[model samples]
Target: MRASRPVELVCPAGSLPALRAAVDEGADAVYLGFRDATNARNFPGLNFDRDEAAEGIAYARERGSRVFVALNTFPQPGGWRRWTETLALAADLGVDAVIAADAGLLRHAARHHPDLILHLSVQGSATNRAALTLYHEQFGIRRAVLPRVLSLTQVERLIDNVPVELEVFGFGSLCVMVEGRCVLSSFITGRSPNSCGVCSPAEAVRWEETPAGRQVRLGGVLTDCYRPGEPAGYPTLCKGRFRVNDITYYAIEEPTSLNVLDILPALVRAGVAAVKVEGRQRSPAYVREVTRVLRAALDACQADPDGYRPDPEWTGALDRLSEGQTHTLGALHRPWQ
Candidate 1:
């Protein structure tokens, strides 16, 4: 959907190069996390250190783009200092906003650093207008990233009532469970995307070549077994093929990307403040291509909302980069639910 006013395009950046790619390719803002447990996507060899983050901020500011630091992970009892220090660093670096999920951390930011823009991360799990309003009123959050579990109707209604700005996922890998609340990964691996900043940590994954084919395991438990010529996906518990009622299939959700190109008009009419592309763990090249395609699509939608159609070339490019080489409307389309 072409909006009456231009909506911001928020892109992800796991590294400095990805940050540069996002801003250079027309992203209005690039979000990244520090290289620590305070942020999600705490995978090895990803994210930025203090120097790198400062460099990234400088690059974005020079390009007339904003930078958001993701201090989105919940800290454990003894780890409050890490989050607080990270927030201090972000403020010193002059970031545009901080995406945070923990209540205590939000309160701290509101009390100690009132000038910093606070954005409620999807990890906060604030799906309803009331939930969002509580965050806005309590912590003075300027925006909230909605969980990817709502239909367009629900999103539209929430936007009309919520006190703060709303950012919805435009394109990304689909999470079967509710964001920030899922514990399936934690049960299997002692790490989680919420607290430890990892889901299915690499150390917990095992791949074995079996007589039947190839077997993938998470925490040494069988998740899926793929035949020789078939595509085997990453070993996450939710996207794993399992047996139920004598059927071997994707019991939770399949490994498909979320593509909302057809629903941009509806989102625009619904008054969405921003559309976020979710791929901080992806390669810089992937970030560049995805940002470019979405930027063009949004422009095209604005040029002629009534005549807007999904560009085949754009769809093909995203599909080629998507997990399982496929994409879906996800929870945005009611039927997908």
Candidate 2:
């Protein structure tokens, strides 16, 4: 056995079937959320109810995999009780950890349920060691998920400084904005992604076929227009093409996914406790295939970090599932900054 423990493989579970697929595919842990605004991915038909969460947790535990409940969204002015009650529900469900972003929610979790393992969500946006220290000292957080904005060098530096465990995103959709602060969707749809749990929510999205091409609009504002043969992506404010200076281009960000298979060894060697896969909004097949590939890559890295190489088959599988059929290191590999 290696002297150090292997980095954990954390997977996403949008439903009970996804939870089972993850555990069966070799995930060390799976993270999910309740079907409410308390979690970030509050889509129309996603997330778990109380009984489903209980069953998922039970299934994971039976297979030696852990379950984390994401109460990761900020509670609105008068909605604080829902946050607290969900934390209570997490404890009652016997989940392994509670991932949260709100200061008050973390404080309550620390004070009221001292034994509960608190994980600072990526939405917490704690980029530096100082912020990690504050949360560790005040809220007793055991792990903190890093926002996707940090470069690989920054992540290594933070790991050397923080007292708590660190988790980083290894795969999934790339958010152009900082994790918890985007208000673009709310500005257009009047539904806050931070508290209401969706960006460019489904109801506000409209698709219509025009003679020029197929166009998609968010809250009646044209987000994107695609040629007849081109692929039409989901309409989101950030990923939309806008006309600026008489030139049409993706002003904010083009649609892409983050894939870190090439750097799995570097992260494993750098003392990261867990590698998280984003997308509780995806399907069970998505959860299964991603978990399968990452599990294989992680196991290989653990066995021999220096000699580890990402398998071609693994790369192909992830590429097929990637958003826009393209991938980037995201901010992990910086140009100059």
Per-candidate count of clashing residue pairs (backbone under 3 Å): 2, 0
- Candidate 1 stretches greater than 4 Å from native: 1-5
Global lDDT of model 1: 0.91
lDDT of 2 by residue, 127-146 (tens): 89899999999999988999
The TM-scores of all predictions, comma-separated, are 0.98, 0.97
Enumerate residue pairs that collide in model 1. Answer: 1-264, 1-265
Counting only residues 3 or more apart in sequence or on different chains, how many pairs clash (N, Cα, C under 3 Å) in candidate 2? 0
The positional error of residue 103 in candidate 2, measured at the CA in angstroms, is 0.3
What overall lDDT goes with each candidate model? 0.91, 0.89
User: Which ranges of candidate 2 are over 4 A from the true structure?
Assistant: 1-4
Candidate No. with top TM-score: 1
Clashing pairs in 2: none
